[model samples]
Target: MAQYSPQYEMNRYINHYFTSHACPPQETQAWFSTPYAMMNYCQQNRIGAILPERFLQAMGIAKGYCELEPPLRLPCYLVYKKDNPKYATIQVFVDYIRRVYHIKK
Candidate 1:
């Protein structure tokens, strides 16, 4: 499996998924920091990739990559200063994000 290096936030979750699953161990064929590069490589080489939904959307599904069923669920959290004076704007942004992702904070 292809492994991403350079330590992006998603890398932690990807690592966790691999370690927790019974799938074959990931032997790094290439280290890609960005989703585009990894998606391109996977497409050209006929290899499977673990990519985020945003990346897949950006790359276009017409590339003929089959999305596995029951998408990988990664836990996420939104954190902010509770005592900050500009809490309203933060709350609005947080609410927008929750709506987009369909998640509760």
Candidate 2:
């Protein structure tokens, strides 16, 4: 098995779901250096939905639509068919977080 650094693990986690509009080299580096901060920002920005959506889509939850269990009360629907909706959503979330939290990473 290959030995992985903390930075490498953080990068893998972030890039697995999030992609930048431009190159993400700087952002990736920042995330590697401050994974906890990145996670805190995500929590503050209410990004928990992003992961569920990604997982549902990966499990064949119809294009543009997600299935939510009861008690959660999340609105799930088929909005549109896109090639990379998860990536797009992630980018939007990133932008929102950056703007709302003054993130400079």
C-alpha TM-score for every candidate: 0.65, 0.20
List residue ranges in candidate 2 displaced over 4 A: 1-85
Best-performing candidate as measured by TM-score: 1
Per-residue accuracy of model 2 over 1-105 as CA lDDT, tens digit each: 111234554335434433433334322222223334444445465332223454455556456434533222232233544666597886677678778968675
In model 1, which regions exceed 4 Å deviation?
A: 77-90, 100-102
What TM-score does model 2 achieve against the real structure? 0.20
| Per-model CA lDDT versus the true structure | 0.74, 0.43
The 10 consecutive residues of candidate 1 with the worst lDDT sum are 62-71
For residue 73, model 2's alpha carbon misses the true position, in angstroms, by 30
